[model samples]
Target: MTYFRSMLPMTSEEMVFEAVRKCLDDAGLDAGDVDAVVCGSAPDAFDGYHHKGLVAVEPSGAFAKPFSRVFVGGGTGVGVTISGWWHIASGLFDKVLVVAWEKMSHPYPHAQPLFRSIFEPILEQPLGPNLIWIFALEMRRYMERHRLDKELIARVAVKNKANAMDHPYAQLGAKITVDDVLKSPVLVWPVHRLDISPTSDGAVALLFASEHEAKKITDTPVWVDGVGACLDSQYWTNRDLSYPYYVYLAAQQAYKMAGITNPLKEIDVFEPYDPFTYKELHHLDALLGKPGLAPQLLKEGQLERDGDHPTSPSGGLLGVGNPIAAAGLMKVAELYWQLSGRAGKRQVPNAYVGVAQAWGDLMQVGQVVVCRA
Candidate 1:
């Protein structure tokens, strides 16, 4: 038995408190019944407050209760949810509520400057590099190495935004075309404005409970069968720029835990992180354990929502706004909705198992989750 509920809040403190309140309300369980709480958010520089975990405690209602906070850049949101599952699965807790949020509206130098903290201070930062530079570089390498053109990448943007047309929470929904993306103003060499996820302010929360507790909560429960997360060495320069090794390791661990040997055939849908268009393809190759097939698949339109293995049915970061932590959890939330038959127009036909993944932090961190209906 599995049942989960989520909340999206308006403020950082309120994000935590409202998530707890919504979980309790949706499941008809009192706050006292919760046995543990897990929280996640991006760095303090982005939030303009240090030790944000401490500030989140009171709002999370974790006073004297088992609680923990995990951070791994954009992967932190999914990391927190996986942490909550561990507590319940390990028999340490009967119920766990996971909360994730990011408030970019708090006066700060547009996320680019704050993103510098993820780079090596003595080396990378001196070059005045930001997140977009890395993504643009990756995109260029991906294009050159694979002999793929920008039009294909632009098509990804078009498809994802078109899919987001129905997503209520999406901030960048538009009926765009490959030409539109190609013509969009370039921010970095090959990366254009349309290719990037917009900085957003949002929060997301999820409730997880043991088998016994889940049965009593809701009729439709989506099981959290597998969860995995991993980080590569922070030394980004040491690794190959084209492929993401962390995503491969994370997906492998999650697939093994879920008894999934062939992700392309076993999983019904995908929600790969797409802060940049190329990431979605990069993660797809990793998720399928076949780096050679990504370019072929993209050329054939296999990654589209109507394709054999539909990806980003919730519009992903490319379509939906990127609230950092919340953005990753939004993918998980999309899986929950789809598996429960709640996704109205965006629902995939006969979806059984769904996989959602998030990659971030100097391109060294990956978080993955597998859900079953």
Candidate 2:
């Protein structure tokens, strides 16, 4: 028997419901067949609402069912999916439904100000820093140490947006260039408006079934061969900004579970969190346990869709729009599509296994999933 998985976009509760309906339709199953539901999202401040899990229950078909909600900032979506997979793999449930959503547009002062709360209020806030500041600082450090130019960073934006052109749920799609990114209004030093993912309102749903149920439903079931999640101390000031220690730890755990001794050679594709261009490179280094290769890959155009190891083939958060929790789930969805041979034109050639990772909340949390066709 094998395990099966599916994913759909999250626009609203209604849209989420419709996507779940489609997933059930595609799987030839119904809401009654599900054993449990796991929902995830970021803080209420970003959504301008509280108890979002309750609001999602009825629409997501979790009503009257065993349901749970988990939050870990941007890692919430992957955290929920990992939870759902565990429920089925633990001999408790045969099927699980995972839902992740974010409505950043609902907030009054925009989501930017709300993210400031994630930092240490006494120290970081007094310094007049926001989320972009951290990313900008990370970008600056990466460029200075690695000798990368702004043009290379802009290429990430261009490639991701171009990839988004084929994504049905993509929010920003354009034939952009490096010049477009450099010329875009600067939000923070070294971080331009185009470098950031927009505040979006969306959700994504995924269905996972146990080996017994999966084999009965489809001949080719994408296996959840590996999953790893870890958190570092919330004290951001104590950590090194040059590299993400949490991401490395999480990758080490997931790679071991997947029996992958060499990630660069064994893994077919990658979907690292690209909330910022530097993040893609940051995660790649952590995932591979070597930061030195990233610059070479970028210089040789190996990180593009047509490259040796395609990263962010779904355009990632940068191109697809960042709906927080939903963005991570979207990367998982891309892995599912690629593994199932349904990615259409965006498909990576002969991709047998893919790794999707999400880093969240001051680079303190890391979630990694390894899926196989």
Candidate 3:
């Protein structure tokens, strides 16, 4: 995976090739060994090009191979890995290459403005609602519902950025305190500059192999125990912003497939998408099927790298950088590294089972993957 950064010198195709090449090398294989390829990118608007997926075909090493791309806004990252999982599961391919890349820096002025197009033209667009504004509303709802202090919520950024200190790919890793977060410039009410992840340019690639081929590749292959994805109503106004019901539904599906009856006890590590600070706690609750539990976990320091249930040990989008599709996949990559005992300094001890989730699309889409080693 390419390092998450505000800007990379390479083009989108080069980034794709670089990640795919590294993935192949790590697996002791070559592009010819991959029977199929699946690519994920958030939007053509971010790349400033049409058919962004097709443009990545050659660089993704999909020439004359079964190839396709998947997009679900920010969910595209983990969504692509799920797509690759099925390609091998369906008995169609033994080896599959999954590539997720985003170049949010290409959008003029800022990538945040590109989000305006995601809203409905007739109703939502008139109000000029972007992701931050909508998320600010969601954050306020969560805070008010649970009566959570802004300082308590700020700990998410503090913990994640500090955790990123050991991450080589992290973009915003720092040793920040909650006081530092509360003092940062406020972009929207309750949403400080430190609360949001920086827009970035990066790519992440993963190789999926069938049980038969996986044994040949590595003795410590991380298995995809289950995968789930769900999309709620497009009209974001109709849903309860205080909690994410969609994420719970998606997590239930994945846990059930993995025979996980008790997630809080069975899952050793978590990598929930954290484009915003509160989202880490929010999604953690959904993943655990216990609303209001995440904030408490944070307060208790159970979400830290050395805590009982380590979360976002890769720094997450908050500190590592938000490269859309790549950030989500990076979570899955973190799981693979952690479970395989290869996470280096950020490694979670005895991390046998891990869950990674990503949300997007009008704040209603949820994508989840469960991995075991």
Each candidate structure's TM-score, on Cα atoms with residue i matched to residue i, is 0.94, 0.95, 0.99
- Say which candidate scores most in lDDT: 3
Model 2 residue runs over 4 Å out of place are 1-12
Ranking by lDDT: 3, 2, 1
- Window of ten residues with lowest summed lDDT in model 1: 1-10
Best by TM-score: 3
**Residue lDDT tens for model 3, 1-373:** 9988898988999999999999999999998889999999998999999988997899988999889999998999899989999999999899999999999889878888888888899977899776788889999999998889999999999999998889898899999999999999999998999999998999999999999999999999999999999988988889989889999999999999999999999999999999999999999999998889999999999999999989999999998899999999999999999999999999999899999999998899999999999
Greater TM-score among 1 and 2 belongs to 2
Query: Candidate 1's residue-wise lDDT over 234-353, tens digit each?
Result: 887777777777888999999999999989889998998988887788888888887746667777888777898888988888888788888888889889889988889998888889
Model 3 error, position 355 (Å):
0.1
How does candidate 3 score on lDDT?
0.93
Taking the tens digit of each residue's C-alpha lDDT, what string does model 2 give over 1-373? 0001112233357656765677777788888888888988888776556677777787678889999988888888688878888898899999888888777766665667877777787767888777888889888888887788888878888988898888877888678989999999999989999988877777787889999899998887889989999888888767767778788888888889989989989988899888887788888888888875776787789888889988898888888878788788888988999898888889889899999998787778899999999
How would you order the candidates by TM-score, starting with the best? 3, 2, 1
Query: For each candidate, C-alpha RMSD in Å?
Result: 3.3, 3.8, 0.8
Q: After superposition, how far is residue 271 of candidate 3 from its true place, in Å?
A: 0.4
Error of 3 at 238 (Å): 1.0
lDDT over C-alpha atoms for residue 192 of model 1? 90
